[model samples]
Target: MRPVLIALPVLALAFLAGGLALTRPVTVPDTALAGLTGDAIAGEAVFWAAGCASCHAAEGATGAARLVLAGGQRFASEFGTFIAPNISMHPEQGIGAWSFADFVTAVQEGTSPEGRHYYPAFPYGAYRLAARQDLADLWAFWQTLPSADTPSAPHEIGFPFSIRRAVGAWNLLNLHDDFVVTGELTEAETRGRYLAEALAHCAECHTPRDALGGLDRRAWMAGAPNPSGSGTIPALTPDRLTWSEAEIAAYLNDGFTPDFDSAGGHMVSVIRNIAMLGDEDRLAIAAYLKALPPAGD
Candidate 1:
């Protein structure tokens, strides 16, 4: 009995130690951004394409007001409601104080400057594929943005879901930088793939997720159920989306479908951001969508 009790305590200690190691934050090296110069002009395009304003801007903000990233948006998921944090240029209330390495860690590795894991709601898994130069440029552009002193709201989560450390384990399982669309060819399609998969994170919502909340890549862009439980998110695969490339490009540019239907729901917000992009970019997105294999194939 004495031997059994000793072994039980030893096992418990081992388990605790293992958990600590697993949850340790994964960060980029301080030298990761070394020698890389940031260009704010290029980053402006990346910012709009990534739709940073969609989740971080003040609710109901319009026009140039969208540039103010005072994040207080609420995102509901199966786990809980996650609030977008203030990412404005405010030194205290936002990421203005973060170094380029810190931004890279947060955006690419989903680890905060304080070595904490961020929830998947921020979509770093997709953002991880972003080019290092783009990240540097983004950081440069971030610095140029107007400062907002809006404090971040805490996420409304419960129990195990609220455990930020557990997110490290989740990252181990689901976080990857691989391109979803393989066997790509055209230069335009390649560019489009990067835009859709990395920057815009179209798959984050357009694709279905597994029980653990990781993307089900097999169904890639086949659409998914709305997390709000209101209705289904439409599939973007060739199986369902048969729109012509020209029509798709037009829709992205002006929010008008082939049938003259305007973009609605959350897409309206998405279109607002995409509309700011160059015409070539909209066309690239269309070409990329046209290149995808039908769902289930």
Candidate 2:
């Protein structure tokens, strides 16, 4: 009994130590931002491509109001409800005081200035693929947006899921810094691949997950049971969609399918964001989708 009691305590300490090591925050190198100047005008395009307003803005806001970014939106998941944080330019209520390094760390490593792990709900896993230059531009453009005085609401997650340290283990399995869809490519296909896999994060919605909540890369964009627990997200692969490149581009630009059916559900906001990009960007995205191998092939 005495030996058993002694061993139990040792085991507990080892477990705790392991958890701490696994969840350690990753920091960006100071040199990452060196010699990089941000372009606010160009950053506006990155902002739209990243679809920041869709999640960070106040719920139900439209038009110019989407730019407010007060961040009261609630996302319900099996883990719990996550409230989007205020990312506006307010010093106290938002990220006004954050430096370029802080922003880059948050986007790429999912670590905050205080070294806390942001919930994966923010989709930093995909943002991890973003180029440093694009992030610099995004930071500059974000600075020009209106500041919101609204404070962020706390996430309503419980128990194990609420423990941010556990995210470190999750990251180990799923958080990759490399870009998806690598290979030799034309300029349009390359641009589209980056837009889809990095900035737009289309996979976040269109792909399914395993029981551990990590994306099932084997089934990439083959559609998923929507996280909202409603209708299915359609597969975008050539086998399922069969839309011509022009039709895909037109749908992205105008939200009308070849059959005149409009995009609905969460995709409506996605279309709106894509609409803010140039025609070439829309065409590029379409071209990339059309080039994808058929699902399961």
- Where model 1 places Cα greater than 4 Å from the true spot, the runs are 1-20
lDDT of 1 by residue, 1-297 (tens): 233343443345435645669657789998867899999999998998888898899876779889899999888887779899999989999989988999999999999999988999998999999999998888888888999999999999865566676666667668776888899469888989999999998998899987667899888899999986688888888778999888988898888999999987678878888888898898889889988889864
Q: Write the per-residue lDDT of candidate 2 for residues 1-297, one digit (tens) a residue.
A: 233343343345435755668658788877867999999999999999999998998766678887888898888776789999999999999999999999999998999999988988888998988888999899989999999999999999876666676677667778986765667778998899889988999988888876667788877788888877688999988788888888998898899999999998878888888999999999899878876766774
Backbone clash total, candidate 1: 0
Q: Worst 10-residue stretch by lDDT in candidate 2?
A: 1-10
Each model's C-alpha lDDT? 0.84, 0.84
Q: Which residue pairs overlap in candidate 1's backbone? A: none
lDDT of 2 at 177: 69
Candidate 2 TM-score, true structure as reference: 0.92
Please name the candidate that would achieve the greatest lDDT relative to the true structure. 1
- Per-model clash counts, in order, read 0, 0
